[model samples]
Target: MSLLTVKNISLAFGGPLLLDGAELTIRDGERLCLLGRNGAGKTTLMRVLNGDLPPDGGDIMRRQGLRTALVTQDVPADLEGTVFPIIASGLGEQAALLEEFHQVSRSLQSSTDPALMERLAQLQKRIEETGGWQMQQLVEQVIRHLKLEGDAAFAHLSGGVKRRVMLGRALVSDPDLLLLDEPTNHLDLETIAWLEDFLVRRDKALMFVTHDRSFLRRVATRIVELDRGRLSSWQCDYDTYVQRREEQLEAEEKQAAEFDKKLVQEEKWIRQGIKARRTRNMGRVRALRQMREERRARRERSGTADLAVQQGERSGRRVIEAEHISYAWTGQPIIRDFSTTILRGDKIGIIGPNGSGKTTLLQLLLGRLKPDEGRVKLGTNLEIAYFDQHRGQLDEDRSVQDNIAEGNDWVEINGQRKHVIGYLRDFLFPPERARSPVRTLSGGERNRLLLAKLFTRPANLLVLDEPTNDLDLETLELLEGLLVDFPGTVLLVSHDRAFLDNVVTSTLVLEGEGRVGEYVGGYEDWQRQRAEQIEDEEKKPQAAAEKVQPQRPGRDRPRKLGFKEKRELEALPARIEELEAEQATIHEQMANPDFYRDHGDEVAQLQQRLEQIARELEQGYARWEELEALEG
Candidate 1:
């Protein structure tokens, strides 16, 4: 059944019509993905559907009393309290019911008066009516799935963690419709895979905007695109959507070309002959005029930007070398005894989980951070241009031109002076937009500005940290092309699987331990190798254990273990279970609103301890698996 219907939705801003009579029907259990170039009406349309924005003209018909939740892109920076309280607030009515029930229970515990008994009974009835217990269970599940620390301060978490908390809040609501904006943007590959599985098992409808191709293929059941002020739908997977959209665009272009040719021929015939104005030729003239009007009114798709990066002076064969480098934060090791020599023209990708120190390693290599133990040496004549993920260098109050020129009207590119506006045009910023403040630009535009600034410096080594964050597909493609064609050494830290696959030749992996390993391909290639390696390890261990089977088939002998090994073998499982129980207790404490409200200051400390326990639990599980293999 269709859950919502949008009819003749018309919206416009100051510059142009964003959505021209757009219409859509969102059905139940549909996993829809919205796609388009940056600055299209995708987010705007989502806001309208989520009831945050009203279209200039439209009729939105939704199921009566349908619950919907939108996980917006912007994190609530001003939101107070710990993660638990923030997410619990999304429970809406159920939260109220639970709070009232708790209050009644507290009162009843102190006084067994007749009035208290009546209030407690009413509160219990309301809690049952609203399914408060079930809602609480769902909220806990979301929090655990996302690995969010309920007691952690919402404002202190990283951008990625903040995004995860927001996602958890929306999921806990158990809404009929879920609206997600770039849900997978800041998540690691593992978290993305988990979310894909989570959404796949869900029956509720989902509509999200993301540029992650692999995620789209795995999560989207239907694909919709906002193009040329209209919405186009494809009831297919990511691969099929791409193929069909290209075919449709090709057909349209051919049809328009044919019409244009015929109209030109008719116009020539009417002009070349004096009798063309007669009654017989009137029909041909009218058709020609109609074709002209149609062509003029049609809004063609915008052209792709030309992103060209010229090669700088060649450096020595070795671009960068880390000789036994080690870095630690407060005695917690991030990188230890790691050594890698980056050669000229090498495109290496750095990947791992969120806190694996990929960005830290990049800084260490680029001379931004001094190593704690070993030396980081650069090649002769080495010039580095680093693109920081935070975009801290850009001034939001300044104009695009001012930023690019850095208080000057001209920027030197390869020893030649170029006007700032002319250089900005290369990155798709027109003359008018160049004068606008950086704050007004979209994410993609800001990314483009970063690129523009990076190129003006002329460096042989390019270091990018999460460069694909705010970039659209077109700009990503352009950046990929530029990287492929550039004659320089590149080191990148990105979470984008497809982008990494297309650009990088090798990868450096950090597993959040003090170890860094090398892989000879992109993210997918690394995953494949890792899976095969694990399989091989499992098979070898099993085969070895089978070879050491009891000498006599009829005699069953108990396996003997040394004192240390025996104690470890006996205590590991119990320890694992104890850790798990502790985690559950922490989660329960955090999920309770009353507890969180009363102990907000203790939340951060508890979260830190919880994180430590989680790490230990993971290590313990791995050790348990190894012990089991040995016992076998």
Candidate 2:
């Protein structure tokens, strides 16, 4: 059955029509992805779905009994409330009524009137029948699956954590209709994986508004695009959507071009006719007039060029190297004995779970950190620029042009003291938006401004952290093209798997605790490895068990330890201690700035690896320790 239907929905903000004649339908178990450039009315459409924004001219049909919810990035930053109350929003009116019903039922059960007792029993049964007892567990599962496993206060949590809390809130009630607005924006890779798995088993219809390509591919069964206030739907996944959308745009462009050419030709011929051509050729003139009328009726679809990032000459043969580096935060070591080497034009992507020190490693490479125990080295003439996730370099109070202008004190084009307006124009910023403060710009705009700043720098090696945030699809495509053609090297920390696939030739993944792994190829190669691992496990379940845990299965009796097991247990403690020491050393090295100038990037990378190895070593040790201390 159709869960909800929207027809001819239209909404206007000030003078600009955010949505016009947008139509969409959500069916039972349907998964749809809403795609468009930033400010293209996706969020507004979601609001229309929830009936929160009554369209200026439209009607909606919904199931007689169904609930809906939206999860957006505005997950109140200064959340003073408990996580329990946050998740309760998904319950909608049922939660409120449930509470009121429970209180009234309790009061009724205590009354002497026989009618009251019967009514109380009926209400109690209804509440229990509605899965009241199971609801809390559902909420907890949502909480855990989204990976918000900590009890820290909301203010202390990162934006990503709070976003997960909001996600949990949205999923707790299992509403008939779900609207997810950029759910994966701030989530870590681990959480994203968990979400992908969770969404696969979801029964409720889902309408996801997101720019994350991987998330769309994993979760969406259909794609809908909002163009010029009109919504069009496609029956396909993200890859298929890409092809279809491109074809549609190409066809539309061709039609518009042909119509325009014919209109020009008609006008030219009409002008050329003059008095020499006569009323005798009246039919031809009439034909030209009809052609102009047809041309006027034809719709024109226009596309703007995405931003362009130019890469300057390579700095040196050896761009960056790190040696025996170590770093720690609040006594928790992140990098240990890490070493890595970067060649000219190497587009390296650093990825891992959150708190894996991906950002810290970037800082160390860019000479922002002083390794406690080792040194980081850079090649002579190597210039580096860093783009942090928060856009730390950009002045929030200043204009977008001010930020870019600060990169170089001089002007670039014609040396006319390039104003902030000129720089912003090159970035596709309109004249009205040029003077706007950085705080007023949308996510995509800010990201564009950041890119503009990066391109204007003297750096040959760019280290970008979470550069995909708030960026539109157009800009991402531009970035991918730029990276592919860039002459200089790039070292990046990004969670966008698709972006990594397109732009990165090599990968350095930092698994928390101080270990980092290097892989060649992009996301496809990584997925293949994971698939092989799964296949191998299926082929040898017993072996896999032995590799990960005890080999015993379906056994009530515990097996006695063999000599090999005993030796393994005995060596584990000492091994764990060695790793702990190594982790400490790597953290110290990552903290030192001299490491960048004195050693190779390989040294810094080795320190990163040591950090990861230390983590694995600890896990192994802990497992062995458990084996040795078994009560069995």
Candidate 3:
């Protein structure tokens, strides 16, 4: 059942071997996730499988009649067609027989040839097998799933949209094998979920490389790891992969430690025995040297992820706030009468659909975007830095060192003004790569460059937009470690499930279009709410239930309610309204230009206090509803 048997595959870009003697055996209906650090030949291996790139040394034996469609990251946006026409490319194999019929009809009119008559029947039969005119209908069904039905020009769309269109084109073809490289990179959560279900139910074999941990867990049944020029498979999800890889590494470490002890004992004994080198001693000495080399190699082969986040200055309670802001583009609203706040050291994860204006909201808080209707205000003591997908602030033509050091009067490392070369070296930038242009650096490297700049400046508040994109596994781990321990306030907008789970302190669910629903806890709590919401959606809500269902008493729950409790419950809704009104007043003040110009320092503090009040107000409302339902 092995559909692809790639034996001893070797691929190289220029000098170093990108993939050295790699081997893979993939069978039909196998779902594989390919993992490796950046520049580890993940994309290259996929190219080799899809026949876009040939291996320098190795025989690839593919089963006959095996067709493949690749949703590559580099799927050229220059596809010479409109969005509708590009999707129509999926129906390429079934060229209509109309032209053939027209030619044959003309020829038949000229001469009644028997050979021409037979050719016409064969062409008609082939077209009939391909579903005739129904191929376009199939194409429409698949492309609609991608949500690009009425798009005018594929070429003029954003990078995310074009990626979607390309994926639709590849997926609609119904190939025997599918190669998806970072397939979920540009997709929203709903689209990703749809893709996962499709992959799970598909009959075709699939192999993809993606950083989305949740997507991989749902889609992949097998894991393929490539490291140090070798391939290994794990028949488990990404979560299990992490668990098993750690366990295996621990075993290897223990074995290595035991070997080292034996080597040391032998080395010590050998040194103790000879000032005079006898012929017998010489043989023992040579054996000990070889053992030492093996031990050294083993120690070096182990991988480690390390990080050090410098302690930040004490920040005040007020962190970030946006007030009564309304923004629009092309006469359509993105954020309307929107107000939100984050407290000191708050790690908030912003979630929304791709075009629902998550990035624009981030810009509004970062002082980059101006609201048409209302002014923006920030705390006086707050220091902020942002990370986005494009890494736009980086000078594309400049070197890594130059990009990092730009505009800074002097960069101090260990209390000295660091030389440009040395600064890049500290960030793990190789010396030879110091002179390379910024544009030449890969996605992962550019992110690292941005990190270096951020840390050197060392802001007290960090606003990150899709910070997980293009970061290698090692770098991501290092970043997670730093973010966990850092004292700075963080407002993150990311599609990366694992990253949010690991680092966030709260979740901001952008539901009801662009409106914000704040939740306590982190990604775990958000997931619980989402599940509850989904269940609510599926169930028909009864009017009796809407009255308010009784739940445990506040945080001090499970107590029996008396007459006083009943009266208190009746008054709770009014109190909730009062808190909401107060929050509105604070929001209005923060939005005023006078407040920012004269009382900038007090503005952030007021917002933080307002957030605490808002949470209590929401809880009160929920409690009131619960009591009302119970009474009904």
lDDT for each of the candidates?
0.80, 0.72, 0.72
Task: Tell me the lDDT of model 1 at 177.
Answer: 96
TM-score of model 1 (CA atoms): 0.80
After the best TM-score superposition of candidate 3, give how far the Cα of residue 221 lies from its true spot, in angstroms.
0.6
Tens-digit lDDT track for model 3 on 413-515? Answer: 4345766666666555766777788888777678778777766664778778887777666678778777877787888888787788889988876664446
Order the candidate numbers by lDDT, best to worst: 1, 3, 2
TM-score of each: 0.80, 0.73, 0.73
lDDT of 2 by residue, 93-184 (tens): 54653444444434543344444444434543564567653564455456655666523466666777788787887787687888988888
Residue 167 alpha-carbon offset, candidate 2, angstroms = 1.3
Q: Lowest summed-lDDT stretch of 10 residues in model 3?
A: 550-559
Residue-level lDDT for 517 in candidate 1: 84
